[model samples]
Target: MSEQYPPPPGWSPPTRPPATQPYAAAPAAHPQQRPRQQPPAAAHKPGAIPLRPLTLGDMYDAAFKIIRFNPRATVGSAVLVAAIAMAIPVLATAALGAALDLSLATELTSGSGGESVTTSVDGADIAGIVGVFGSLALGSVLQGIGLILVGGMIAHVVAAASIGQKLSLGQAWAATRGKRWRLIGLTFLLGLTTAVLLVLYALSWVVVVMTTSGWQVPVVYGLISVPLFAAFFVWFWVRVYYLPVPALMLEPIGVFGALGRAFHLTRTAFWRTFGIALLTFVVAQIAGSMLSLPISFVSQAVLLGGVPGEAGVFVLVMGQAIASVVTAAFVAPFTTSVATLQYVDLRMRAEAFDVVLMQRAGLTTSGGNPRP
Candidate 1:
């Protein structure tokens, strides 16, 4: 105190005495105060399909939205596939017709006897008929394969769109590369099952007719079996209506596993799934018919305008092919998108898939924190 030295160079002492001002206390934060929490950033953007739960309308809208989101991969792929499918069948039929015509002309020009002409015509007709059917069957199989491929591609696009990602045709195809064979196998299995069921039903009717006599017996058998068959059909359809294609593409499951998974997911939600699927089918069919009706009408008019027989046939075939292509381009994507989004909806309702989707979408941070 005796040395109360002056402040160091360039530093001055307080102008007033320390005791002249009372000590002020620091303000305290209220104990109950909380750091304000900002509302969560949305997981999806407006006008985009959400990854969470969806309504039927949401499913429908999402379907079309996804088609709009990537028409190149969805509608473009469908058009390409449908054109190839229709073209193969049309060309094969044309070739067979040409061959048949050539054989008929050859027989006529050779001035063969009636018997020879009859025999030659019969043989050629049978061969031509078989060839036509064979070509048709082969074309159908290829078309089925193409449809499966398109479905798989649509599934991939819809899935990526869920996570705010866009997929080109090549990218979607790449994503589904591994599942292509599985999809084809699944389709074959489904068709085989349907054929077996039809055969069994037909056999049952035959047995009823052969083993019993009178209208009453057949009528009673039909009455008894009809409801049972319908029930069985509904059960089978509800259980397997949603194919494993979406599951195979989106999940890590194999073909059989995806089938089992589909069954499991629809077990409790059978009616819901059935209703939605039925509605979607009806809507798609109606839309497709509307799109193709004009083309069909124009073709019919052209045919009625006195075009040559062969030319009229060609015009009709070409017209139908074009209609098929257009209808397929618009309708196929809607169906696939509905299936895909419905699959997601089922998974979310049954398995909390929204959480996983959110995580994938980066809406949540690591350790379960919502992003600020």
Candidate 2:
């Protein structure tokens, strides 16, 4: 073996390569070869209302979702309150009508042209008409108050739900207790405002009729004023239609203050607010009609299907009552939920309430996830 020279520093001795064939280029991938796809993202938690600014779809979804989340507090309470409130007025009105009819029948039979009979009958008719009007007004007021209370309860439940909390009927009611009176006041104030506007509208028509030259003039004025008044009504309603019960419930505000706040909030988004309110009302009405119409038809059929006397009347009344209760149970909660959610959405957009909600929910720490 030949003596090897000393290896250089940081150098290594080369070894003989194994006896093998020359390397060949690797095969290329086919053009049709598809890459593997990544898996889809996980779904969000169910029944949780998002705290971010909402879209119309989000509003619709949240409305029904809140009802689903707490049916006992929302739908059940609505059913019970609405049924009682409506039944009282209906029964009273029916009794009054029956009594009035009996009295009129007796008066008519007593004498055809006697002055005493005519005077007594006229007085009775006037009293009955007044009583009927009073009953109707009272019923409307009671229903409005009941609706306000239900709205408050739903607002409480939705607030709890937005933060992953489950609210019971008692808890929701308790949350509303402090604001119940304010809510009632606000409802009354709204009703009063509406009534005043209606009165003014009627007076305008009366004025036109009284001041005009002839019937044609009054008719022409009415034709012109009708569209104008309708437009005004729509505009006014849109501006003040979304006063959320939460504004009164959570804050220290009175009816006027709440109305001012609602007006201000909706000032910037009038059309959106109007559209949402109109859509909610239309949808709720349609749904209620669809559900109740069948019951009404069935009741009418039963009444006209050879059934007569007190039994037929009883069936008709009970059927109508049942239909009303069922419709209220489903429809009231949904409409209230839409209103509450619309308020929340407006607040989120105007006040950045999502930040407050996030903090309340403890979702602002350590990169915690907040549903959008």
Candidate 3:
């Protein structure tokens, strides 16, 4: 303390602070930060398809899924329908074949002393032919009716499946209960219209033939007009008429209403609809052909090769019928699904039907998560 005095002219003492202040104030206590929240998971796929506008691949995949999920409703119904449809024709053919055995055999004399025999058409043969044709027509009508019913059932199944509800065959049939006659009527109307068009087409060909001078002119005209008309027909049919079946099956509307709806739906997306339909048809055709071609060949080899005459023919016909049944069983449901999905896709695009589907599926709520 005594020596604390400045020893030199410029010397100064060190300064000291009060002891109250800590060496370093504690780091300002940071308020704890809460964890950040993550967004909810993507929309849950409840059934065969996601609740959104579907791509072609999605439609195709979902079609098979629908068939797989509701086999009794889809594939089983298809099998039953196809079997019944085929049965009518088969029974008719069998019955008619036995009943209408052509007895009009004519014996001809030949210079080589070898007897030549030929069949001459008489009134009984004509009656038999008419009966056979009538039976065939009846079978065709029944097949058409069965197809319509099956399509309606498939539509019901598709509707249920879109909402994650799997339907049984009974449920599907019940859903399509009141629509059967309407569907058949629609089909008949459509068929009648088609027949009229075909008649017109034939009449047009007759006109061309009558108007043209020679075979070459008619041939050239046919070569040109046939393809053009065929192309136009295919295009028009795909764009306009192809979707009416699904429309009639799914909606509460009648045949004309369905036709109008389909026309409207395809108006905006012709190429897309056309592409999906064409591709689906091509795939179904290829698959059916692949399955049936082998059967046909094998049946011919087994039935015709060993058996003789009418027996062989009968066996071959039966075999072919069975093949058709199997092919229809596998192919029908798939085609039906694709068609229904097309209707759905079109509705979703045009009507925001996906949101309705999601809501029905319980995949959406006001909150971030789905409602419990």
Candidate 4:
């Protein structure tokens, strides 16, 4: 048969087909597979500040932005409170000056036309001095109360603004109704503490001077005490008391609770808080001075040169009161905003408060999860 096949010209042996490779099934789909977690979304800013840990620039920018965000809640309320507080002082000053005929001006005569020069406080009655000091103390207390109340109102504004809500002046004031006295008491306590400490420091120096014979010990004590006490005061001011106003206003805590909250918030963040507050204060001072100094100088010159007696005193006092109101209008809101934002920032850094704020602003899922 093979010889017969070879005789066919075109006949050739056929090879078996190549073996078929086996088909590999895909690995069974993962059972109960874990879903990949999406990354956290970007910080949401529905208000003046971004809901995140804020930098110094962010705080300052937000503070200024707040002033423009709701003028009625900020500057208008500030001006109203300041005006009322200053009225009492202006009246007291005018009454006392008129009664005592007190003036701090000197008369000079250089020409030969029988000109005379007088340099003395002729009407420096003891009662007048007491009245003047008392008046000043009263004014300080009143101003402190006013400032605290205004700060409280502004805190409301800030809180609302953080959630992109604007408050009217009346609404802001209403928020402070239950908290006014607490804020005022806190301010008074802080001021009294500072005064007591200062008195003690002065007394220490006095004792050193009175008890010791040589100047060396007192000098050395002063050199040591001055810097040390100054540092202590600064620390107390920056790290302890500076934040209470915001805390008291924002949270449902009491006075001491606010104080403790402030202390806690400032922990591990003293330098940042201090630097920002100090810089803000310096800026405020410079701005206030720029706005008020020229008017003061003009009034003083008028008192000395042209205006006379109680009329001059009235002019000066009224001018000063007006200047205070104007300055407070611009300065109070900004300072309060900074303080509030600083509180927010510290809480965010420590407790993820940005998430809470975002949630409050309705930028989160109802399941308490942040929205992507």
Candidate 5:
């Protein structure tokens, strides 16, 4: 989300009783005398950046932090984020194409102002284009609605499965029920801002190509900026990728505060975050290649081949659609889950969250909410 706003303000842990509780309650002769204690709960959760080697228990602690705090809410946020991430561009492109096609079809059916056959052909061509655009757009809209429903369902089911919670879809939505609109709006704004930055970054390269001189352009000017841009892109990405989502899901921070918190967490641990992000990218790339890229390439080949017109377009569109949607479904939810996990890891490190985890394991109460 471009991680705008001031640097992360100084943060401090809240003052609370020590994590460890006495093994047993005893009649004390003096009110001032304190009981001996066991090890602190924080020991179970990881502490501070350059995180200590994570054990299986540490990972579970991280996951359970979310589970304990708001079992259904945690799962619901992840699913919603995943679906929207997949649906946005797909819907935009499809809508544009569908609208263009439907408008063109309407014009063509109107007889081209009663002109000759060639004029009618033009009108018909326009109509076909509009129809294609409209259909694709409508397809995207339907896909979005489907994502919202399925994503919500996944959240509830996963929460119920992973945690000892009797969470239903209704409960999951209720966790963030009224606040969904705010989360959605904030997320969209952040996403749009990031996208605009990316577009500008690409356009900067385009500008370099169009305006610069020829002889040494490839090596001297244009290429020099490529490495710099790459560095900036990586830097920006690690710092901000999860900030907005973290803020929306985990805390009540404002947009600026969320961005600041994200970057703040990255400090002293840039390489770690970079590693996670790069790993995510590599995994996504591999999955996309297997699921969509080969199918898309084959579809292009078939579309360009000398075949009956309608059959070629239909085969290409339907085949590619199947490939793309499969990829979307798998990639979106998987990455969203992992990224959300990363956020928990960060919180654990900062907040000594292990203590909370130990407590949740034994909890059976009014809320059973892990102490946030």
Candidate 6:
């Protein structure tokens, strides 16, 4: 039997209709002319994550299980996430440029006598300002939508993969079909707001750089503000960490309610929650370093070996993106996996999941059999 594992604490059980294991009957086949040999029973394994209960290792195990069920999707998801995370700075630049161009826009490009301001498009200033700001806001919103869409997809894939079953791209898509857009919207709301706040934080840095003299001013500003920024980040993160995504995927919940639920669920377990999350992040970093070492060696070796037309800018960018994905992919699968694990862990810890696991594992329960 697989090892027995306990879920985390304070979560409510998924409310999936309680019953025996869901086993679909295979279709009957005709007596073939010369029927193929019957496959071994072991070949007919069930579930994606296997029948074992949850465990601390499940987070790491998810990284493997995702590869096992649908290697391609897992890889694809990795590429997608890596690309997005790497492109964050570029996106941030675009957002900031657009926002400034809108907010500080002028009718003419320059002043009359002393300045070089000039313009041709009449009434275009206001429109241009609106257009620029609109684009910035839209970009932020779109980024959020993209992430949430990807997050939900990743979540479904990881959840399905965890159970030791093969879910087709179609199956994975279908599992989230009904609520993909909703998830996207919810994510967008969260992301968009966060982006706005972050922009505010970043602008404070730029202001210090521009207004202050020499490097000392900027250094002083950074030193003083770093702790402030760090504190705010942690405070905000704790409130929203688990609430929105789960609320997006599971029950209907708003910003406040979802935050409340997350706070409630995480009560007295913040350190554990933060620890697992940190561990997941650390593993991804270590895995990324390991994966990128090969890429770096090859890239450098090619350059040193007198390879022609090597290290092209585009190639470098592409390679970097790929490298980033390689490292981050190690984390993405586990990211969603932890969400599910945390959910189930909370439920089991709170709702007698230990007993359920024992029953499911065929152990002799206190009541002779585990309650359904």
Whose lDDT is greatest here? 4
Worst 10 residues of 6 by lDDT: 41-50
Off by over 4 Å in 4: 1-40, 89-140
Q: How well is each residue in 48-122 modelled by candidate 3, as lDDT tens digits?
A: 877778899889899988887778888788778777766765676566567654323332334355756454556
By lDDT, highest first, what's the ranking? 4, 1, 3, 2, 6, 5
User: Which regions of candidate 5 fall more than 4 Å away from where they truly are?
Assistant: 1-122, 137-167, 198-219, 293-308, 363-372
Error of 1 at 126 (Å): 8.0
Clash totals in order: 0, 0, 0, 0, 16, 18
* TM-score of model 6 vs. true structure: 0.54
lDDT of 2 by residue, 107-149 (tens): 4333556544533456765576566556555655566567678
How many angstroms is residue 363 displaced in model 6 relative to the true structure, after the best TM-score fit? 12
* Tens-place lDDT digits, model 4, residues 164-235: 988898899899988999998898888888899989988988889999998899989988988999899999
Better of 3 and 5 by lDDT: 3
- What is candidate 6's CA lDDT for residue 4? 67
- Give the Cα lDDT of each candidate: 0.78, 0.73, 0.76, 0.82, 0.54, 0.58
Overall local distance difference test of candidate 3: 0.76
As for lDDT, the candidate ahead, 1 or 5, is 1
Writing each residue's lDDT as its tens digit, candidate 5 over 174-274 gives 65554455555655666787799789977876887788877577567656877887788778778875544544555666656667788877776688767
Candidate 4 vs 6: which has more TM-score: 4
What does candidate 1's lDDT look like per residue over 181-209, in tens digits? 88888878877897899899999999989
Q: How big is the RMSD of model 6? A: 18.7
Query: Model 4's lDDT to the true fold?
Result: 0.82
